[model samples]
Target: MLAQTIVNGLLLGGVYGIATIGFSVVWGVMGIINLAHGAYIMVGAYIAFALNQWFGLDPFLAMPFAMVALFVIGYALQAFLLNPVMHTSLLLTLVVTFGIDLFLIDLFVLFFSSDVRAVHTAYSGSSLEIGPVLISWVRLVAAILSVLVAIASYLFLNRTRTGQAILATALDREAARLMGIYPDRAYGLTAGLAAAVAGAAGCLASTIFPISPTLGISFLGAVFVVTVLGGIGSVAGVIIAGFAYALVQAFAATYLGANYQQIVAFSMFLLILIVRPQGLFGKPFYGES
Candidate 1:
């Protein structure tokens, strides 16, 4: 039972890790809380759902389309909307994002009609058994792909010039400007990339969970908790913290009852705040600190 629980937690954590990476990156790079992140995720899921339903494309194959679409949306948001308020107080920015979130949710309801949709592939219901453990194929694929995405993101942030520039801006905007990095463009690009990652996560999630407008905010608490717990500025942090959070939830559900799962989870968040506020892997900038 314990081993099965652990496997379940790890699998869930892999998906959760991918889902929260963008939120971590955006907050770390731009200092924007991005209440609209959940909206971005929902859009991605819908994109995959549409593709699967209309043309019978696999959600994983449709990932790039969702990423590209979201990249454009995210970049435009920073260029036209967020950049204007770059110097505004954090509270104002928070309100602005909150409003954007509401607008996106409204659009989903208006168009998608709050219908719960899900993507089902031929293999979605299949599972693999290894000795006494059984693993759902969809979840296994999603988890593997999620880890691969995280690794790709890490390499992009570390190996590419554009990524380095984003990191430079994140490290110190003034210093980045001195080095000819345009903070505005960097900010926009960061948002675009973050949204792209979020989109990919949504694609992965569509395969595993039911989709609906109401599910837009489903990841809100989990992402925040994972981001803060894993430390604000790290990719590896999200991956690690994702598994940890999933394990915590699984154990709580198993031992304390499913009802207490979130209560315990949030309690851990509070405890983390009071005890080690910086998080186990917290740093000033991802990879820099």
Candidate 2:
């Protein structure tokens, strides 16, 4: 049972890690905490469901369409609204993002209702047994996709010129500008990439879990907690933290009451904050001492 729980957590964590990577990329590159990030995920899920229902496309194949569509939406939002607020105070940005979240939630609820929906494909119920581990094929697929996306993102950030520009912007906005990187365009691109990642995760998550407009709130917390525990600027740290959080939650649910699972899981977040305030991998914020 313990081993099974661990596997469940690992699978869940893999999906959460994808969401965290998106969150971290935006934060690390664009300095935006983007409270509306989960809404984008929700939108992507809906898009996949819609395509599968209407056009008979497989959720996996429909994911790229959802990703591209969300990317455009994210790009436009950043280009217009967020770009104008680039020089504004952080508090103001936070307020704006929260407002965006509220709007999206209401919009989705109005359009789709609050009913839970899932993309129930034929393979959704199948599982593979590898020795002691009983792995759901859907979970395995999601994990594989998550790792692929994360590794692709890592390579893009490390190898590509535009990717390096985004990294430089994250490192130092003023320095990036001095080095000929256009800050506004870079931020828009960062936002788009974040949305794309979110979309892909959403596609996978919808297959594993039911979706509702309010689902984003729960996912928002999970992804942010994972991101905070992992560290803001470290991709590898996010991956490790994802698995750690998953294991922690799975253990709590298995040994303790399910009701206390959240309490135990977030306690780790608090513990990490107290012990390593700079995050597990990233350096401390400027002017800490």
Candidate 3:
């Protein structure tokens, strides 16, 4: 039971980690807290759901299309609506994203209603028994995809030119501009990539959990805890922190009750904030005189 619980937590954490990476990336590159990130995830889930319903496509197979759709939406939103106000106050950006979130929720509600939905595949109900642990095939695939996406993201940032530009912009926007890197372009790309990842996460999540228009709020809360726990800008930190957060939740749910899971997770979030605001892997911004 203990080992199985640990494995379950780890698997869930991987999916959670993937979902939060895009949120972290947008913040890391653009200094925007992106309150609408959950909307992107919701949109992706709907897209996959629609494809499966209409075209008989498998959710996993429909994920790319969902990702692409979200990428376009994200890119357009950043390029047209956000870039103009990029230099504005942080509060303005927050309000903008919050408004966007509300709009997305309403739009989805209008179209899909508030009914809970899930993706049903042939392998969805199947499980693998490896000695003492039994793992669901759907969850195993989601976990593997989550880890792969995170690794790919890390490699892209470290190895690619556009990614380097994004990192450079995050480090110092003025310096990045002096080097002929357009901050607007980088920001757009960052937003698009973030949305794409979020969409993929949503598609994977639909396989494991029921989704609805309002489910984004729950995901938003999870993203906040994971992001803060992992350190804002570190992919590796997010991944590790995600697993840790999942383990905590899993143990709490198993021992205490499912109702206490959120309470424990939030309590840990508060503890982290009080003890180490910079997070486990985040760099300290405050300098000693």
Candidate 4:
């Protein structure tokens, strides 16, 4: 039982990490705590759901389409709506993003009617038996996809020229601009990439969990903790902190009941904030290699 419990948590950790990476990236790069991030994921899940119903595409196969759509949405948001007041004040940015989140939620509610939905692919409830531990197929697939995406994101930031330019621009706009790298273009691209990751994660997560218009915001607290714990904007940090957070939640759910899960998680979040504010994988700053 204990082994199975641990395995379940491990699988969930990947999803949790993937979900928060978008939130983390936006914060790391744009200094914006995008409340709309959950909405973005919600949008992706709906896109996949629509594709599945209309064209019979597997939810997994719909990931790229969802990602592309979200990238366009995110880019337009940052380029047109956000850039004007981005540097005005932190509170203003927060309020703007919060309004954006609310707007998206309402829009989803209007179109989708806020119904709880899930993607029941061919292998929805099937599981693999590894001795006494039975792992759900959907979970295993989601975990694998999450890991691949996370790794790809890490590589993108480290290896690609555009990524390096983005990192440079985010860390120090003036310095990056002096080197002839445009901050506006980089910022827009960063937001687009962040949303794209969220879209992919949403498609995978829809296979494992229910989808709904309001389902995205419920994750805000947990993902915020994960993002901070993983050292905001660090892919490796999110992976490490995600697994740790999942393990904690899994164990708590088993031993302390589900109600205690959030209590315990938030308690740990406070403890970590007080003890090591920089976070598990947090660095003083990110620079190109």
Candidate 5:
């Protein structure tokens, strides 16, 4: 039973880890908290839901379409609002993102009617058993996809010219500008990429969990907690922390009781913050003033 629970936790963590990476990138490089990230995921899930309901499209296939739509939304948002404030106080950025989150939630509620919905494909509930451990196929696929995306993101950050430019821009905008890299353009691309990843995650989440306009708050909390615990800019750290969080949640849910799961998560977060404010893989300047 324990092993099975651990496996389930690990699978869930893998998806959470990938989804959080998008938040990490936007926060780490752009220095923007992007409070609307969960909303982006929520919107993406809704897009998939719409596609599935209206056109009978498969959830897996609808993901790319949702990703593209979100990419455009992110690009436009950064190019117009966030890019202008990159030079201002961080609090301003935070406020702007918070506003965006509120706007998005209301927008979704207006359009989707605040109904709780979930993708109900036949395979969503099917599982494969290995010994005593039963693994849901959807979760396994999500886990594999999450790991692949994280690895790809890592490679993009470490290997490509544009990627390097983005890193330089994040580390020092002025210096990056001096080197002929346009900070605004880089920021837009980064936001677009982050949005696309969030879209994919949202689509997957729709397949596994109930979707509602209000669920964004809880998901945002989970993703942010994992991101902080792992490190703001570290993809590898996020992956590790995601699994760690999942394990903690699963164990707490099964042993300490589900009612106490939130308390455990928060307690661990508090303990980590007190002991290692920089986080497990966070840098010295994380959440820098």
Candidate 6:
């Protein structure tokens, strides 16, 4: 039972890790607490759904389209809307994002309705048995894809010129600007990349969980806890923390109850904040002390 639970947690954590990477990137790079991050996830899921419904595209195959769509949306939002207030107080930025989040939630509800949906594939119900452990095929694929996404993201950030510029901007915007890196363009690119990652996560999620207009809220909460726990901006740290959190929740749900799972997770989040505000792998950002 313990082994099975561990495996389940690992699978779930992989997906969670992918979902939170975009959130971490946006926060780490732009110092923007994007309350609309979850909205992007929701939009991605919907895109996959629409593609599947209309053209019979596999969720995995439709992910790229979702990514492209969200990337454009994110770039535009940052360039036109968020950039104007980029120099404003953090509180104002937070409020603006919050308003945008609310608007997205309402928009999703109006268009998609509150109905719950899931992507059904031929292998969704299949499972693989190894010794005493059973793993769902759909979840296994999602987990593998999640890890690949993380690796790809890491490579992109380290190898590509644009990615290097992004890293430079994240480290010090003024220094990056001195090096001829346009902070505005980098910021927009960062936002777009984050949205692309979120879209991938949402595509994976559609295969595993039922999605709804309000599902983004729950995902947003989870992302917050994971981002803080893993330390903002640390991709490897996020992956490790994701697995740790999933294990904890899985064990809590198994031993206590479903209701206690979130309670325990949130409690741990609070304790971590009180004890080590820097998080497991977090370093102080530009303004942070």
Q: lDDT tens string, model 3, 40-116?
A: 98898888889989988998887789889989999999999888877766558888899999999999999999989
Off by over 4 Å in 4: 286-289
Off by over 4 Å in 2: 285-289
Model 3 error, position 261 (Å): 0.6
TM-score of each: 0.96, 0.95, 0.96, 0.97, 0.96, 0.97
Per-residue alpha-carbon lDDT of model 1 for 1-289, expressed as tens digits?
8988998999999888988888888888888889999989899999999999999999999999999999999999989988888676645778888988999899989988987888989998899998898999899999999999999998998899999999999999899999999999988998998899889999998998899975659888899889888988688988999999999998998888999988987898898878876677888454232
Clashing pairs for model 3 are none
Cα deviation of 241 in candidate 2 (Å)? 1.2
**Candidate that beats the other on TM-score, 4 or 5, i.e. the better one:** 4
Q: Decide which is better by lDDT, 2 or 6.
A: 6
**Residues 150-240 of candidate 5: C-alpha lDDT, one tens digit per residue:** 8888898889998899888888889999999999999999999898888888887888789999766878878978988998877789999
Cα RMSD of predicted structure 4: 2.1
lDDT of each: 0.88, 0.83, 0.86, 0.87, 0.86, 0.87
TM-score of 6: 0.97
* Model 1 TM-score, 2 decimals: 0.96
* Cα misplacement distance, residue 287 of candidate 5 (Å): 4.8
In terms of lDDT, the best-performing candidate is 1
Error of 4 at 7 (Å): 0.5
